[model samples]
Target: MTENKIIIKLDKDKKKELEKRFSQIGLSMNDYINLALNQFLIQGKVPFEIKSPSYDISTLKTKKAMLKTEEEDIGIIKNSISNSDN
Candidate 1:
């Protein structure tokens, strides 16, 4: 993988806040930034899966996207019905 440099400007207070948060989560500033980048590229969301005390980290990491619920699928059905009704 090609490594690149990115320079970001943050206010002093914001930088301090970010450093504290990252330290609390056991991630260095670099690692936290990389995690954010990976989330943006891989899943397009942060905190991708639910965190559970019973589940291992690997299990949580491996969780797939949830299957669409029946209610979610009803949109297509409703659209078709509306078109036919017209």
Candidate 2:
């Protein structure tokens, strides 16, 4: 069988994260990616669910409010960390 090469770019942090995850699962990064691609080819679609977030108004409002709360919490945590370092 003939082989070909494919080059893809990944963020350094993401690459390291994936390397760790695949290692825990006993697969190399190349092997995991190839397995995903092969499954897609055989199934004619991704091997996972693809769905859009429900666009109902209440859902959107709740999500937005939660995100804002999370942002505030993150800011507080950062400030506390910086204060501790001082």
Candidate 3:
């Protein structure tokens, strides 16, 4: 079943252009607007491509802490191996 609905207060030129585009895609005005709105609400972003840049942290203290953890693990493993040989 289909129901009739009315939309008020849209700019005439914009609505006409939208209708033309919608017709090209084989969709009615309501369908085209609803599809666009549903996608926008669900995604919360535009459907266009974007580029992001990367960053690096060059902190010596952080690197030293990581190395210290690795050294401690290696020492534990070596001790465990030596004790198992008894």
TM-score of each: 0.46, 0.59, 0.38
lDDT of 1 by residue, 5-69 (tens): 99989999999998999899898889988887888788867645667754876665555222233
TM-score order of candidates, top first? 2, 1, 3
What count of clashes does model 3 give?
0
* Predicted model with the maximum lDDT: 2
Which candidate would rank higher by lDDT, 1 or 3?
3
Error of 2 at 4 (Å): 1.1
Query: What local lDDT score does residue 44 receive in model 3, on the 0 to 100 scale?
Result: 95
- What's the distance in Å from true for residue 32, model 2? 1.0
Model 2 agreement with the true structure over 1-86: per-residue lDDT tens digits: 89788897999999999999999999989998899999999999998887667877788999977787787687843332244555
Q: How displaced is residue 49 in candidate 2, in Å?
A: 1.7
lDDT tens per residue, model 3, 1-86: 69667666789999899889989999989886678677878999754555443322446567766777787687843332344555
What's the lDDT for all of these models? 0.70, 0.83, 0.71
lDDT of 3: 0.71
